[model samples]
Target: MAMLNQIEAFQPENGASWELYVERLNFYFEANDITSADKKRAILMSVCGPSAFVMIRSLLTPRSLNEVAFEEIVSKVKEHFNSAPSKIVFRIQFHKRSQRLNESITEYVAALRNLSENSNFGNTLDDMLLDLFMIHNRCQIAGSTSNGTNLHKGLSAI
Candidate 1:
C-alpha cells in the first residue's frame, strides 16, 4: 500500500484538543499491530516520557530521516538517550523528567535497519518507501523477498 500525503492544515476542524488527538492516534496505532504493543509502549516512553505534548507534535509533523535529516534526528535522539539513559528494571519505566528523551526514536533506527537489509529495495527503495509512507502511510513496492527466494516458485505459490 502507498502512504497518503497528510497536510497539517487538513486535520479535522471539530475543535479537537491534545488529549483526544493522542487517544485517537494511539488507537489507530494499536489497531495496526497488536504484537508491537510492548515495543510501542517502550518506544513511546523512551521518546516522549512525561510530556503528553510530544505525541501531538509527532502527529502534526511528518518525520523523514533522509541522509541529511537522519543525521540530525540521530544526534537529537542520542543526546536525549545519553542524558538519562534506559536501565533494566523488572519492568521498564522511561523516566519522564529525563531531559531531551525521544519516545519513538529507537523505532526510527529499527526501520532504517530493516530497509537497509533489503538489497533489491536498497537505499534507493529506502527513499521510495519513505515517500510512499509519507504519501499514503503505507508502502508501495514491487513484490520481492529480502531473503533469497526463487521468484518463480514464490509467484507460483501465489
Candidate 2:
C-alpha cells in the first residue's frame, strides 16, 4: 500500500532522530485513518530501522508477537529509546539552563520548549512557571530597574 511505502521510506534513526520519526509516523497514521491495532503493528515492524528491529526481535519470544498489542509494542520501544526524565532531573536541567550570550530570544525559547516537552511534566501551569522562571532568571533587560516586573514589562523595557 502507498501508506506502507511511505512508512518504509521514513525509518527512524536512533537517539535524537527518534522523536522526529515518531511525529512523522503519527501524522501518517492520523492522515490515513490507520486505527486498527494489527495494521499499526505491521506498519511499525515494517518501518523499523536495523537497530530497532534487532532490539524488538530480541525482546520477542516465539509467541510474543501473537500476544503483544500494538500499543504495548510502541510503549516498549519508547521506554527503551526515549525514557522520560525524572522530575528532579527535569528541574535540575531547567534551573541550570541559561540563555547563551549570542543566542536570540527566539532560539532560547525554542530550546526551553524542547526541554519542557521532553520533561513530560504534563501540566500547562508548570510549563508556564518554568517559562516565567527562565525568562526572569536568564533574560537580562537593558537598563531595567529591577527584576520584580512581569515578563512583558521586562521585554518592553528592552
Best by TM-score: 2
Model 1: per-residue Cα lDDT over 43-103, one tens digit each: 3334333343253335335652221232243345444334432233201222111112353
Model 2 C-alpha lDDT versus the unseen true structure: 0.64
TM of each candidate vs. truth: 0.18, 0.58
Worst lDDT window (10 residues) for model 2? 8-17
lDDT of 2 by residue, 88-142 (tens): 7866675567778888777766776666665565656334543554456655463
Consecutive 10-residue window with the lowest summed lDDT within model 1: 90-99
Clashes of 2: 0
